[model samples]
Target: MKNLSLQWRITLMTALLIGATCIFMNVLIGYSGRHYMDSIGSHITGYEETGGEDPDFFDPRRERLDQELTIVIHGAQESFIATNWYITAAAALLGGVLAYFLSGHALKPLRTFAAQVEKVQPNNLTDTKIPEAVLPEFRQFSRSFNQMLDRLDSGFAAQRQFTGNAAHELRTPLSLMQAQLELFSAEHPEVSPETADFLRLLREQTERMTQMTKTLLEMSELRTVPCTERIEIGPMVEEIFTDLAPLAERKNITLKATGDGTMTGSDTLLYRLLYNLTENAIRYNRPDGTVHIAVAYEASCLHITVTDTGCGIPQPYRESIFQPFFRVDKSRSRENGGVGLGLSLAWEIVALHGGEIRVAESSEKGTTIAVSFPTDASAD
Candidate 1:
């Protein structure tokens, strides 16, 4: 009973109720019939001696009348018990069917609310909310859920604005510091080896900070960016591969692009999306490793896969790889000049285009990332 679904529970309870009512009615009828029969017998016995008949006389006709009356009442009792059993069974069956459907009908609003909730995403947070329901309880639930969504929308907006502002503010100071450090290093050509090493380290840190700030700004603005241009997948892949070929060549890694697909999106953002993925593939790969890019259309959706023969991501880290500032191998990431934001930025770009990005496969051998986007020209 505890494990039963709502509909089943409702049906069972309804059937039990109907059966109980029928049993109670049957018991009342039987009791009343027996009492009436006893009263009539008493009256019949009293009347038998009313017409100057012997009080103790065994009258054959009177005996026959009494016997017939007893038979008739006993037969009626038996008929009623049998008939009531059939009626109770039929009522229980009917009640179960009605309860099953009635429960489903009553829960339809909750099902609709769940479906709407599933479609809500950060990019479209403001536009999605639970619609009003007719039932009072469901209506209240919808109202509360909409209020929660409003708070979430406000919080996300504030976070994005703050990130953008902070990133913008940090960039100017970083640029000025980099220029000042370069001027000081050039002016002090006779500095000790230790001072030169310190200055070089300072310059490197400043550059890293500048890159991080730029990535942060890009991530912050992704929510407000709109994708309106139609891009051919084949050409875009070719161009991205060409642009990143130098980086791949430095490690003797091979870059290959194949298949044809197209989607509607911002070209700049899409470029960044592919660039980050390809760049990571190149940066993390072993010498002479291969990076493969493929795009294809399936069921009105475009599928893009990037596979790299690099040191694969661990299973535990794969889930958090797209999170900002999360790195699987911190030391390796630093050596590769990674600030742990490439995949995070890629994820944001994919979300902005209303697509999905996921690590399709990973192991000690290598890793593969698959992205899917609606092929519809109007998808955003």
Candidate 2:
């Protein structure tokens, strides 16, 4: 069937090829056997025509020539038939077995390559040594895989440098503003109500700036961090809900945490994971709409689904939603007060945690994002 896996497909194809070759050989041998039988029958007929008996005409005359000729013909027929069947069957079975093993041996390097790729971490990505192989097929695969790793290592290094530079640059201005605000407030102890309100607005803006800067730095760190620690994901989801409930309440968005979300990863990354989903839910939700957080295990993987009763993400932009600085509606995203890095950070965090985040479904009704984190059994 078309849906069969690669190993089975390879084995089946090999077996079929062997079977076809065996059938072809058998046909050839059958034809030869028929020719041999015909030649012997003609020789006997010629002897009968030339002499009174086949013995007189045949080489090395015998008393019972007809009987001897008939016995020889029967023995030849049986031997040819038996040999033909035995050789064909033996060749077919041997070819099939040989094919199966050869196919497996040829693919062994690929299997090892895949396993090596799975264990690659950002910190150790520079170590891209794939074991050598004498076979050309494996050698080519190794070269390509190493090339890809080289590119990834360079890309991640560049990203780290950029993140470090950006975070410092953004933080410097906020730090200056905060210090200036403290000095101004201290000096203007007798300031008027209007001036005080203005000062408060400035302080609020500075605080928001500081929070946004910290979130950006955290996102950057998440990229470089190897989440070696295991975390209880259910409690993490519950904690995130508890922390963000007030914000949802302020917007009249009801947030509900349901199911048990148990997975393995860093607590910080898990926090970010829940935060991004909840924030998206709250930002996109309609007035008095509900945001449901469902966390459960499925197929030996932890499934954390965030469903929101909001205007769904457009089909065209669903993939782009995870791109940095990408927003469905610029004005709406601006009104929501995010720089459009929420989903991007979420995606990176999930990826770093060795999980997959995807839009399971979306429609005019709402959107559902399903995140799958491998269980301990799976991770091993």
Candidate 3:
């Protein structure tokens, strides 16, 4: 009963009520019939009575009448009970069927409301209100739901505007500071050791801030990417390798790509996703270790695997690695000058293209990250 759906619950309760009523009426009618039979029988004839003229004579006619009355009353009671039981059973069954259908009809609006809520995504938030012409019972609920959606839309819009403005405002000052510091370092190569150290630390921190702001600005404005062109994974891999060749060389890690795949999405965003994955693979990897990239098409999906001989992520941090500013080893990440937004941006990019990214496997030997882009079902 606890696990039953609302519809079934209602139906069962209604049927039980109807069955109880029928049984109660049946018992009442049966008792009334028995009482009436007893009253009529007692008046109609006596069960045993001796004759008045003769001392030992019996009245067989009255005895026979009494016997007939008993038989008729018992037969009528038995017939009435059996017939009423059948009628009670039928009424319960019919009541359950009617209740089930009626309950389904009553709950149809809730199902519709749930489906509409499911379809409300960030990009498609406008005009998400349920129509005013809906049933009176749902009108208030729908109005409240639409108002909540309006608040969410406004919040999102305000957040994007603030992030974009802040990033833009901060970028110029950071760039100016970086240029001034570099120029100063070049002009005075004879600075004191303490001053040099302070300047270097300041430069690193400034660079970190600049990178974070740039990434944030990109994220804030990533809503309307022109994803018209089909991007080939092979060429994109080549480009990322060329850009990060110096970083790989510095770490003495070998980079390799195997197989070819293609997907249709924003080329710029997709490039960043791969770049971030590959860059992280190289950044955290051991000296002379290997970073391998593999792309393939399987089951109407494009899968890209990046495996690196780096310190593997712990089991608990696997999911949190995609979150902004989350790091498994904060100290090591800082040594690599990571702001922790590389993987976060990668995640957002993959999600924008309706893809998935996850840590496929990790161990002492190496870690493998898998990215998949789903294609149209018709292509399958």
Candidate 4:
């Protein structure tokens, strides 16, 4: 909706064109005037210098007449030049003003088209009908933009459908597993302690699998959820710290959070983003190391940084770390009980909120991952 964006570059070009034309026109007019004056002055001076009407007679009185005639010709030439100069100056001024206004009027349709495009929301993105623009040449461009919107809307719909179906399918098996484990445990109290312990571990693993499946399904659903809610980011960060403190303590790691501010986004998504970030920091930290969480409101974004004194990610693999199923050290990932989707989910959540998440810095010293969200977006 800005009045003077790069889309109006054509306006500047039009002004330049008008300026060049004015300069060229003035130059041509001046050249013609000079030619006319030279020809007329030479003929009159020649006639006066010759006493006879013939081409070759010379006299003292005739020479004096030639001087007078030259003066008069020069005065007339000056008057003609001055008049033309005024006319040309007025024409140049008028042209410049006319060009400026004309350029703005010509670009008005483009501005309206862009404003319409900006008004599109995710829910209505599937609609392919773009508002008609005044300029015929822009119709094709409008069609292409609407087509892209349709494809994106279809993509998000598909993702949502897949997640819904997958969650339904997984719930049945998860329920059966829980029932079987409960029956087995209830019927086997008379068994040896080791056998009981084994059954307990089996039950635990099954529950873990259920939790993982549910988290994965939620992560998939988060992709399609419109992030239009307002969030008190400071409180959200506090809640994450409270939730993960016990887990960090179990690993002999100290987890801490600092800074307080509000940001815009879905509360569920913001929690997920912070959870993944903090969990990674704690999981990767060395024994008894410190994991730091900081939140600060910057110029236009709310920044959350998670730093850990862990086995830092190598420089070569930083770019790939946010990709699903990507692990710098596969064995290390297994040791940390990671499926390599945590950061990927975090990345998607950040992107859904029109923000960004990345490993801002990494080395043997430590690694710092920053997740940022726009401060203007409301958190749901």
Over 4 Å off, model 2: 1-101, 111-129, 133-136, 178-212, 223-230, 377-380
Candidate 4 local lDDT, 252-350, one digit each (tens): 998777887676567787788888888888888888999888878777677878899987898888889988778888887766777777888888777
lDDT of each: 0.86, 0.79, 0.87, 0.76
Order of candidate numbers by TM-score, starting with the best: 1, 3, 2, 4
The TM-scores of all predictions, comma-separated, are 0.83, 0.71, 0.76, 0.70
Residue ranges of candidate 1 with Cα displaced over 4 Å: 1-3, 26-83, 187-191, 374-380
How high is the lDDT of residue 91 in model 2?
77
In model 3, residue pairs whose N, Cα or C atoms come closer than 3 Å (at least 3 residues apart or on different chains), thus clashing, are: none
Lowest lDDT block of 10, candidate 1: 371-380
Question: For candidate 1, lDDT tens digit of each residue in 1-380?
Answer: 99998778888898889889877987887787778877877787678768687777888898898789778877877887788778877887888788889988987887888888987887777677876746888888888889999999899899989999999999999999999999999899999999999999999899999999999999888866778888887898889889988898899999988888767889889899999999999998889999999988777788999999998988888889999999988998888888999999999888878788999998767889999986554322
Model 3 off-target regions past 4 Å? 1-5, 28-76, 115-124, 127-133, 249-262, 286-310, 354-380
Better of 2 and 4 by lDDT: 2
What's the C-alpha lDDT at position 209 in model 3?
A: 98
lDDT of 3 by residue, 260-358 (tens): 866678889989999999999999999999999999888788889999998799999999999989999999999999999999899878766767899
RMSD of 3: 4.8
Ranking by lDDT: 3, 1, 2, 4
